[model samples]
Target: MRLMFLGDVVGRSGRQALVTHLPRLIERFRTDFVVVNGENAAGGFGITEEIAEEFLDAGADCITTGNHVWDQREALVFIAREPRMIRPINFPPGTPGAGATMLTARNGARVFVANVMGRVFMDALDDPVRPLEAALDYHRLGSEVDAAIVDVHCEATSEKQIFGHMLDGRVSLVTGTHTHVPTADHRVLPGGTAFITDAGMCGAFDGVIGMDKEEPGRRYIERTPGQRMTPATGAATVCGVAVDTDDRTGLANWIAPIRVGGDLEPAVPTRWETA
Candidate 1:
């Protein structure tokens, strides 16, 4: 099975780039399932029902979010009915929507996807390990699901890497998000899970993260919020990771980064299979 996981989508530039490229990328790569992080899709804050639908329409089978998942008030209501979208699993038990869902891929393979948030440098929530353990126990790969993915939306690279190692040999991929900057490490762990500290944001490369430079630049010096941050309206590079999993073990056999447009050098990985 083949899968694609994209990092945070920041504001308009990210949304546009995703809507435009996702379909083409799916076809070019022959991906079976796609999961996108859309927490920042709405003006670099929360995602809306409309934006979630847009992502679904553009080929994403599931959407994952982080701390900003509820920035939009409407999300609280709409998310109850939208099973394709998932928030951080570590959110208090009563949180409106679930953190994991079983979805059928385009090729008819069952795919299980979960989202986990880190406590380090962020909100303190339930331990991710337990929820992850429970989810995997219920949706055992190779037997119940054809593939599994865990999006570690975290601030610390170590936390993300720790989650990656914990799930190694059990899940198909463990990709990180929250930090807009992409990491250099992209490799299949010794246990066969594909891991990356961050998948990077799909937005302007010329600004602070995805926000315009002026506001953040001033705040860094003045230590005060002078103006609200807005998404940078500039050339954007869509970024993500693609992986091919073993059909029997549901573990990654091949992995590569997918970066396109904007200031970054283009990288569309070679196909996973030569035959």
Candidate 2:
């Protein structure tokens, strides 16, 4: 099965870009499933119900979130109802939204999508590692589920790398989010797990992690802060990763970065050519 995992979608700019071009990209790639990180979709804060619906309308099978999952007040209620919009698994026990879900692919394949947040430099929460193990156990990898995709919403590259290595050979793909800058290390791990340090943000590439540059630049230069920075209003790109898994073993066959439009370089996964 071919799965596309998009990084966090920022504000209007990110949503607009996805709504405008996602249909074409989906059709062209023949993607079977698509998961988009939407933590910042609601005007640079947490996702709102309308924004989540917008993503679903644009052909996303599931939407994942991160630290900003609860930034918007409305999310507290909307997340309770929407099973597709996932928050980090390691949030306090009473968190509104779920951290994992089993979604059916177009071909009737069961794909488990799990979302977990890292503790390193993040909000204090439950141990991320434990729930991940439980979720994976419940999903029953390769048997009860055909494939699994994990979005490690985190800030530290070292923690993300550790989680990827821990889940290697068990999950089909493990990609990082939160740090909006896309990393260059994209490759299949030794254990066949498709891994990337960070999938980047689906917002303005020119700004600081999708936020307007003016406030951040001023804060850096003047050393005196103003109001909080807002999302950049500009041409945005939908950045993500593409993973193709073997239907039988549920192991990754190929992995590639997908950066469509705006300033970043675009990429598509081709058939793996043996060297």
For TM-score, the strongest prediction is: 1
Report the Cα lDDT for residue 22, model 1: 91
Per-candidate clashes come to: 0, 0
lDDT of 1 by residue, 40-89 (tens): 99999999999999999999999999999999999999999999999988
Instruction: Go through the candidates in order and give each one's C-alpha lDDT.
Output: 0.92, 0.89
Global lDDT of model 1:
0.92
For residue 172, give model 1's deviation from the true position in Å.
Answer: 0.3
TM-scores of all candidate predictions against the true structure:
0.98, 0.96
Weakest ten-residue segment in model 1 by summed lDDT:
266-275
Q: How accurate is candidate 2 locally (lDDT)?
A: 0.89
Residue-wise lDDT of candidate 2 within 163-194, one digit each (tens)? 99999999999999999988999899999899
Q: Which stretches of candidate 1 lie over 4 Å from their true place?
A: 273-275
Which 10 consecutive residues of model 2 have the lowest summed lDDT?
266-275
